[model samples]
Target: MKKTFLKIGLLFAIVGLLAGCKDPSSEAPQSEGPSVSTTGESISEPEVVLTDEEHNIAVNYIARSVPLVIERTGSTIPTNVFRADAEPPLPIPELKYGNDLILITYGELKYEDEINGVYLYPEYTVTYSYLEGENYASFEFAVDDKGDDYAIPDYPRYDAEYDSGGNPIHTVPPAKAARLYATIHIGERSTRFNIDMILHPQEIIYEFTLDEARAQPMGKIVKVYGYFNGYFADWNNGVICDGDVALGLFKINDYREYMQIGKLYEVIGQYTVYHGLPQLQWIKRVTEVAAADHPTIAAPEAIVVNANDFAEQLDIGNELSGPLKHKVGTTVILNFPLRYKKMLDRDGNPVEPGSLELGKHADVVLTGKDGNNFEFEVKLSLNYHMGIDDQAAFRDFFVANPTADIYFTGPLGAYDAITLAPFAFEGSLSLTPPVV
Candidate 1:
């Protein structure tokens, strides 16, 4: 977590000065506008334009006081309020009268300035409005971007840790300060003020099951409670299962090394879809539950489907519903024995048996009991259990057992078709002639 400290002393001093010296009835120049009186007669309401000094005072007062009010009232400021660069930026929340709301209607990064010939800080324009009634009065401000007429504080930056790839991780940038010039209207009188304040990121974590997490809109950060199902492919990626439903976990933090298989754990990350498979990416945290507190949970059982019915099982209307849809991210076993056909690449192109390389895959075409052709990928990787030294050894086995019965057990992944990505060669793949 990153820490952002607001200068309370300066803010309170500004607030104190404005509270004592500001006049509620002091009216600046009025803009022409139609207002209905008690008698229904039209009149102009004062649209006050405050002087430089008055504008500065009002801005400072609001900037200092609004945060206190928000904290005291337990108001939730919108997360997208400070994100000027969000794609299809979320709508600023509508203001309601009773709540202490700080509505940021518009925000943008405007300029960058160098400080003491070292650090560069970016400035932003934050236009906002708040309602005033019995609780508080309404005020609107549109601060100009040009010149140094108003003081805009430097945006704060915190030290962030970087990954081996040199990408910053576990760091959330602080929102930049913007110039604020506010016109406060109370009854028939109005005044103006200006100030600058820093915006902090408010992260909201939602607890969900694996099914619920997958149903969430893409790119949503969610926390899921489930049992760690052990890593597949590498230690950084694995699956977490809640009952029969599971989600792939990728790029998890260091805590993954301590995660025990089949243990109840809370995992937090962003929900994403790679190809057609739903997975949790950029895993932020993983915490194991105490065995005494939680009843021991076993790993989810793999749903078995015969090879002849594999295609039909996955043939739902869309990816969102049906029997196999629930099994998309979960484990599955292809039970029926497969008769070997021909080896091909992912694109169905055949290569010489001697051409396959280590850590590379070739699709093995096989015939199911119903004589329907299905593709099962075979990756030639380090398989000490099978005593296979290289791709040559894999080729010799396939050549010797040209008509072997094959069975696959692994998580069902999808691309052009539903496929099995076996994590291990020993248990995940079986040959009729056996590995020997």
Candidate 2:
């Protein structure tokens, strides 16, 4: 039989051992069996004795390890600068077999010291509950680099001053390598796995321009220079543009400090297509190259489009030649005689406009000129400064005026088809038509 190795939890399993190891800590509560040693050293392999529940969990884990290893064999993993309150790593799942529960704990392991590598200090006693009737066994371990306790020299910090938009300004850290290790303890038996990951700065392509980067193949990592145009708080991303072309910056949490509207920036990331929209994901770096003293300096002007032009542009596919192709990722002012068809949720289910929920996207379908239908995804949640009552009032306006000459501004993106992603409704939407 062919042996298959898989990723059980945080790290993939390369090899498994049935030997008993030193207990994690002396302070940990003792399990209901023979007392495990606490000497912090490897002991001789003991006779294996597992109850039916323990045997099932271990069997399920060993059975599923192969594909996980193959899946993550060459995957790029994001690394963060060690912070005390940083978000915890994703949790591992617990496998269930019958009525008995099998608890798994993260054991201690040695941290590799690569040059300028970010270290992973995994918690030792994270517990997971096994749900009833599930056959698979999985576990999650929280890893963080304990603040000053394991501080390295020359680590970068955010600047004390805030930008005009109240966002803190900071310098991005250089890429580093990291090798993480963790021990998985199932009942009395333990297995160890180590993950080798390059923290950031993976194969930088600083030569590519924003437009050139867009042409590169999917999943290719590239670095581009552009100006910060706008942020989509609803989607947790921002838009950046060179003088000619614009690209969406996905997942700004790591680089939020350097984000300021109209500032020039250098971004390094993997080019990806999210729901048909071109975006850069797993952003490695966002460095402000030039500051924007005024908001209008680096902001890209929105392209004005009428309903007929908008529908014609939407009909042209992203790869085909059309006016909207060049306008993707940039803002556009759309003026159309509105005819509301229906409202839908992200999953494409019909939803009454008045019943739209907060923090969820309300995808409203509207009939354009020549009966061309396009979607307007209302992202009022992105308007962070809006009150609940104001948001509701703004939402009701769309349903209330089902047929009116309306104008709105939003970044032109594609999701299954052309979409107008309006981050806020205040200044973007108007009942009266624009002067275009």
Looking at model 2, residue 130 earns an lDDT score of 17
- Quote the positional error of residue 275 for candidate 1 in Å: 1.7
What's model 2's lDDT at 431? 73
| Clash-forming residue pairs, model 2 | 4-66, 5-65, 5-66, 6-65, 6-66, 92-139, 92-140, 93-138, 95-136
> Which residue window of length 10 is worst by lDDT in model 2?
147-156
**Cα lDDT for residue 57, model 1?**
44
lDDT of each: 0.49, 0.49
Put down candidate 2 lDDT per residue, 129-201, tens digits, no spaces: 2111111122222222321011011111222322333243544333222222223454465544433222222
Q: Each model's number of backbone clashes?
A: 10, 9
Where does model 2 exceed 4 Å of error?
Answer: 1-202, 291-299, 370-394
Instruction: Please write out the lDDT profile of model 1 over residues 139-256, one tens digit for every residue.
Output: 3322333211111122233533434333556566433222233444432334444322333333557787677888887677788877777564445467778667788887654764
Give candidate 1's error at residue 189 in angstroms: 50
